[model samples]
Target: MRLMLLIRLIFLLLLNGVVLSYAHAASLAYEFSRVSNNSTEDLGRQLSMLVTEQSGGALFTFSNRLGVPSSITDIYFDDASQPLFSSIAYHSDSGAGVSFDSQAAPANLPGGNVIGFLAGFSGDSSAQSVEGGVATKGVMKNGVNSTDEWVSFLGLWANAGSFDGLIKAFADAHFRVGLHVQAIGLAGRSDSYVNQPSPVPLPAAAWLFASALFGFIVIANRRKV
Candidate 1:
């Protein structure tokens, strides 16, 4: 009887641990989409709606990271306007040099193109620009632009911040911005051209796992007694 109780206890612990780990591994992912020929207001509305739906009616933050001032102000549309709200004062990523050039073809801002920028728009002016087709700015650290040479824009988006601010700015500037969201990360850095996702804790699954584990521990203790 003692041996059976011990085995069950161990099995319960293991199961609890497995469930918790699975919950932790399940990160928050944003459903991203590209917007086309739409005003920044329109984009904001869509994003706000998406956040409400995804976060279950919670007020979430939004931002934008444009490599160029004009990209934030211009490009999203033909009209010049202001954003709904000023960008929040957040630290820019140091380490690598990042920039944006709208005149560059193929990379020129448009309705359907997606781009990624380094986390934290803060950095040196001299670092090599992520523009010109070399995407994926690798782990930005210490004000140096040490991004990998091979990654492309799409790859950068995989780890970029959501450009919620830029989208708002564009709309305020009277330009229509349309974007199709692909995915949202719980945590990540943002820049002028790209919006990285951040890492966040798991949802209700985590709580459920914890409750199960607690119940298991109590039952196991009673059996041992």
Candidate 2:
């Protein structure tokens, strides 16, 4: 029994190492911060309407909270809508040692969503480009393995530009996305977060009713306390 317990504890520790990297990495618990729009292509006539559709999912960024101090390896995102990506056109106080990796399909993600993996952040990452629904993935050029908490990557959606957005329209998974931080530092722990779109604004009457209901609940809770 003692031996088995020891083994189990060790296994848990290993699991923690793997998952915690993501946990601490929840981009520092913010999941993704909304960044500005990227320069969309000019397709003349957008072959797909997803470029401007609300359900198509908007552009967001995955950044590190503690990554500046520690090492970072890659960034992963899961979406059933077949997300699109563009090249790195902007950089400010971002991770220096990293470069975008090829967009990969999700091996373990659920909901038939695809996974995009940008690897080699600690070394001279290769060039990155997006083709066939993936981004630029090249070989290491001369990465300095720079690290910082401000390290961030684009979710790469909402890329509608003068080119009429994109040649194709992507049907995102109802405006929901799973942002994942993976394999950072020595432990290689990871964490996954599912982002739900904000609720539509309620009417004034509905808001008033909700406020009254909230007041009643708060009073009741106070009494109980």
Index of the highest-lDDT prediction: 2
Candidate 1 segments whose C-alpha is farther than 4 A from its true place: 24-195, 221-225
Question: Candidate 2: where is the Cα deviation over 4 Å?
Answer: 1-59, 67-95, 105-173, 184-187, 196-225
Model 1 lDDT at residue 166:
32
Model 1's alpha-carbon lDDT is: 0.31
Error of 1 at 113 (Å): 8.8
What overall lDDT, based on C-alpha atoms, would model 2 receive against the true structure?
0.32
Error of 1 at 127 (Å): 42
TM accuracy, model 1 = 0.28
| Candidate 2 to truth, TM | 0.30
Q: Residues 1-225, candidate 1: write the lDDT tens digits.
A: 878877887888788788766544432322223334232222221231112211111122222322111112111212123322222121222222334222222233343333321121111222234544664342232121212211111101112223443333333433232222211222222222212233234356667876887887788788767
In angstroms, what RMSD does candidate 1 have relative to the true structure? Answer: 14.6
lDDT of each: 0.31, 0.32
Cα displacement (angstroms), candidate 2, residue 153, comes to: 5.4
